[model samples]
Target: MTTSPTTISVPADHVLVWSDEFANDGLPDATKWVHETGRNKEGWYNNEKQYYSGPRLENAQVHNGVLTITARKESNSDQTDWGGQAYSSTRLATLGKKDWTYGFFDIRAKLPCGKGTWPAIWMVGSRGAWPAGGELDIMEWVGSKPERMFSTVHTTAGSGGNGKGADAPIADACNTFHNYQMYWTAQQVIFAVDGKVHFIYKNPGTGVDAWPFDAPQFMILNVAIGGDLGGAVDDAVFPVQMDVEYVRIYQKSK
Candidate 1:
């Protein structure tokens, strides 16, 4: 039998700020989410090649208290009018609807496995867009190596931020459900999986291009098919699913 991960405890002084236990069956809560469609002009960052279509019921659905984001292949004729190879799916985020600055963001999930799956639980700034506003990768996985996971931060400072931070690996990340979490504070950011810390960045530089994270940021959950990061999708792995059991947030008491 598969046991659920230990329940994360919150200090009595701190209150439950936000969460989606995914207890309801069907689409996600409309109040807190918006679908992301089409491929960005530059394609996905980090060389990720997949087109992140907005939320589509066919690609993202909840059942039995679980949220499933599925990626599938189709003939050219089956593709959407949008550009890119013949694959269709969705991306969901809590952008304008909700945003948070410093808080504990945790997601309990089972990643998809195959040559071309790229699943991520991360956050973006609420400002303009992309690297200009900063990007925090709380957790990211490339299906080619199911045993490893990655955590890194991006900014105008570019990769590694003058060599202060990096992408660290976590073993056994895909075999079972793991809680990927990010602890954000005014002075620093910590990334962890299953409660084990992996990466940390401190004293983030300055300005929106450098440290936009200081302001409110929203959450994103996606399982992308072969793209720049995951490499080209393996035709053999046509259908893949990223299963999320729940998401929870906590903030330190004032």
Candidate 2:
């Protein structure tokens, strides 16, 4: 289910703050990304089955000006992961490498359509623990729901699958490139795709429990396998990928 698309217009005075165009064909720029390894103790917080690998070309790579995060069905008997699922993938973040308080973020990508695949471009506060700080899911797509995409925000007041969110139906997301964007300010967080606003969350000014995005936050990108929301897996689409053309950040000109 998706709502009617809304028009989005950027403010005139804005400056690029950071970006990765993935020009060279090879591993991602180390200076800009930090790879996450092992499934967190809580299994990535959603029982996600894929083993998140670090610095592996098979899982994360850049080629022909595009960054690819691939999820492959395989075994990792040496490591412990939820369900011990025989699959591997990549999770990239800018946790300590880079972070921002408020800015406009744009990522152009082509999603993967493998059943049970869950791809996301999101952010988490760099300060405190999960939910206590805050989280912003700029874009998320579940393979089971091929035509729907989501944008959500989580805080102490609301988090997880039940977090505040909105959806948009994009029938060709898997085969076509689309801009997943976000404009964040102290007043509100606006989420859009290809210039269409799909979701918005206004700061209540109540406190951290409701609005904990005042602090710095870092970006994250990953693809997971069958989990709470990812329902069931289909072995047929073993090696799937989410292609990212570029990621850019912008701030209001000073």
Candidate 3:
């Protein structure tokens, strides 16, 4: 069963706290991003599977002021020796160098649509580890359902240890560039797409197991190949790319 949407009260007075306009042409600001390497020992957590590793530009690049993450078919020569797979791509994240607690995070981008393509803008806390620290899937979509996007939060207690949080779906998420955003506070987290509110969850009133979002969190962006959620990747659809225009963050005025 799904949980009902919680009430979200946007403060009347707000100001921009942080933002990345991507005004620089060709290449993301290295000062703000650190590429993630190595494969997940258990594979990507969403039951959706993919082996992520590599230094290939075909997997990631910034050109003409846009960041692109492309997934393509290549020989084992292009793949990193993570586990076993010839396909390779890059995953970028701001883990140790930067982190934020409560604020509004927004990403503007156009998605890649094709069978077995998965792209996401998400976050993980900088605390202990994994679901224990907390995870927020701000925007994740499977190409098979290009019309809908999912927003969800995972914590130690609800991450199968207890149960996963509810999911809210948004329509027409791939055809156009839209702002996928999340507003997080000490008590709750609210998710929206293109400025339209979709889902909100209040603090479950337990412990860190139930609410581990009150800590520093970093951002992640990637385009993943078929494994689980993305279904079987169509061999012909390789070289698929995800285009990101900008990422912006705003905090409540102190």
Candidate 4:
């Protein structure tokens, strides 16, 4: 059982530093986001079947104040960049534009409901390689299991199948919008939704292997197709989407 902050809200000591309201309709703001391509690392690259459509409005777009990241069961012959994948999706990141060391992240979004769809709103360290640099997953929801939402921490000391992680039971994940949030500082990271606390990972103070989050990190939002964690696909549910109403970040005034 967990209890503390039961609702998501901006911290009184922090001020808004960066945000994307998605008021302008079209592709995401070029100044704030980039379509990351290579291998979709949500699951393992080889295990994930969705090819990320770079900067394409069909896979990712904003309209009427909502940013939609869609995943579809379709193929484009010109996708040699992604090994000619049979499914297409989007992965947007604030990689080069902005990275943060610690802050309060508050986001409102609705998830896609299709068995095999893996939608995540997470962050990774900006420096070095995986595990060594650290990772903070605010939300990772796989359609194969619609009733639970995951929050995890990955470090060199604890990663992969042994990573420190937990989940919260939620039923209206696909149909309704919820606050997916994180509170990161020098000592710990708190993961929550709608103010409800689900998990926390501390700095351990052991070494970089156990605490690698002191460096900068960037945010990622994407919907992946079938993979190791995504499980089996349901072709009939083609063209599903996760909608983001807004993303706001606040840092303590120093």
- Indicate which candidate wins on lDDT: 4
Worst 10 residues of 4 by lDDT: 37-46
> How many clashes does the backbone of model 2 have?
0
lDDT value for model 4 = 0.89
Local distance difference test values of all predictions, in order? 0.73, 0.88, 0.74, 0.89
lDDT of 3 by residue, 1-254 (tens): 65554433334555676666767755456788777765554455555445565444566677777888877666454333444454556688876667899888879988887888889899998888877998888888888877688787888777633434444565555667888888888988888876677777679788888899888999999887775677777777777778898888877787
Residue 97: error of model 2 in Å? 0.8
Tell me the tens digit of each residue's lDDT in model 2 across 1-254. 54433766566787899999999989889999998874543466577888887788999999999999999988766665444557888899997899998888999999988789999999999999999889999999999999999999999999986699899889999999999999999988999999889888989899999899899999999998888877699989979999999999998988
Candidate 4 residue spans exceeding 4 A from truth: 1-8, 40-46
Candidate 1: residue 199 lDDT (0-100): 71
Instruction: State, as a TM-score between 0 and 1, how close model 4 is to the true structure.
Output: 0.95
Which candidate, 2 or 4, would have the higher TM-score against the true structure?
4
Per-residue lDDT for 126 in model 1? Answer: 85
User: Which pairs in model 4 have colliding backbones?
Assistant: 6-195, 7-195, 8-195
Per-structure clash totals for the candidates: 11, 0, 6, 3
Highest-TM-score candidate: 4
Cα-based TM-score, every candidate:
0.84, 0.94, 0.86, 0.95
Q: Model 1, stretches more than 4 Å misplaced?
A: 1-13, 40-55, 75-81, 159-171, 204-209
